[model samples]
Target: MSGPTGILLLDKPQGPTSHDLVGRTRRTLATRKVGHAGTLDPMATGLMILGVGSSTRLLTYLVGLDKEYTATIRLGQSTTTDDAEGEVVTEHDASGVTDAAIAAEVATLTGEIAQVPSTFSAIKVDGRRAYDRARAGEVVELKPRTVTVSAFEVIASRSSGTLLDLDVRVAVSSGTYVRALARDLGAALGVAGHLTALRRTRIGPFDISDAADPEGDLATALIPPAEIAGGLFPTATMDAEAALALAQGKRIPVAVTDAPTVAAIGPDGRLIGLISVRDGVSRVLTNFPNSEEPA
Candidate 1:
């Protein structure tokens, strides 16, 4: 029998890199096809989606979805990495900064924005990872890219010891950099800032609550890959003949609907894979084969 193919929503704990969890998941599921939709830093935790077995095909859709995060930004100190991972390069007394000023700064960061990702980021420069080059004592200046911060709002603000801490909730495009928001906000406010804590609350249709421990039960934690695939795309139910044909790479016809992407569900209501209609013809972007585990 094939191992069940599906998405595993991993509530990644702090301290381990994303790759660490992927390795652990491979062992837990006893499969070598484990992969993640998005990469989270070791210090950050929550809502990381993993693909198992044949479900790896779903990653193409998952990676492009919007993401949401909640973070505690500590004003008055900025690090060389623009996050807690780097050394403190600048500090100031942010106690005097008022709530109104913080609100104004956040307002400026909302909507479509051009942000320079953290220097200590995963961006590839000259075909090498930016963080690698940076750690080698090379100055890496990355070009600013446009990313959408659909919503950027300060949820709460309070005094933490001698510093002002702001808790923020952000809904952004897939590649939006929350660390950059914290860094730029501090710079705009004349007080240094760095992300003290961050948790991914949502990634597309999957919530943090859906995630399970990577080291935990494989059977219970396994999310059917079809669930993740259908959740992100428009759903369509297909008859047995159509399902078999699609599984065999035959095109199916789709009726009118406003959905841009459609999930083709079989007669049993199980997802057959995702399909899109163009000029009344269905095109299969992915055909999920019955998943089985390796010996």
Candidate 2:
């Protein structure tokens, strides 16, 4: 809590679990108070949002943001993990699968649909992870959840003897799994499918192009919490008295309607906290500890 506080957009390399990235970030920034907004499989590379120091409080707001990914879906073999890392369970001659058919199935997968996650996912079940249960040779039956897939476009395609590979870009809501989409698409086409590669390109407004390499200069890569809040929510300027009242757990007479939460900026231009307006009054939803500290 005493170190630099800000958000870090990290472009994670493959082969490291999301938790591993956090550990490396903690070491790179020399702060143990690092946290991430979302998780990525060890086999997948992409943009990972990390919050350092007091900015860890901002991760909850970022968790629900939409995500964008570019991936390769193999259309011939289905795997235990719904990815290349998993053992192959089934194979088929995908050479006969037509591009028109692939397009049609992809169209169906787009928009809102119910999808079952892969058995090797990190979803918790009865106080244990589904992947943990799966690794123990137990059958994991995850319930289907509704998720939105705004876009699922096949950017390129390659067909080899008995297999077909598709390079695609997908934009989806939070909690939507790209592996599930690959599995469902393969199943719909009569050939089992699994993700061969995946790279997250964006999360909400944050792009992978702006992300920093965790092994590089991470201390200077931190984005101030105030700047992050300004980009994420509606802004409202609060006078000294109002800022003090909110800090003291008192509701202030600030009316806001543009958003459910407003980024409250103090008179000195420092971020006070996030506040919610209701019935013509605003109350602090989250208060920063050192609001008066100079940026």
In the range 1-295, model 2's lDDT, one tens digit per residue, is 2577789999999998999999988887667888999999999999999988888888999999999999999999999999999999999999999989999999999999999988898899999999999999998999999999999999999988999999999999999999999999999999999999999999999999999987988878888788899999998888888888888879878856745789988887777889888876887899887632321
Q: Which stretches of candidate 2 lie over 4 Å from their true place?
A: 291-295
Model 1, 195: alpha-carbon shift in Å? 0.6
| lDDT tens readout by residue for model 1, 1-295 | 6775677888989899999999988887777888889999999999998888887888888898999999999999999888888999998999999989998998899999899999889999999998999999999999999999999888989996658999999999988888899999999999989998999989987899877877778667777655666667777788889899888888767764735578887777666877777877788778877444322
Clashes of 1: 6
lDDT measured at residue 92 in model 2 versus the true structure, 0 to 100:
94
Q: Which candidate is the best by TM-score?
A: 2
> Ten residues in a row with the worst lDDT in model 2?
286-295
CA lDDT of 221 in candidate 1? 78
Query: lDDT of each model, Cα atoms only?
Result: 0.85, 0.90
CA deviation > 4 Å runs, candidate 1 = 160-162, 256-260, 291-295
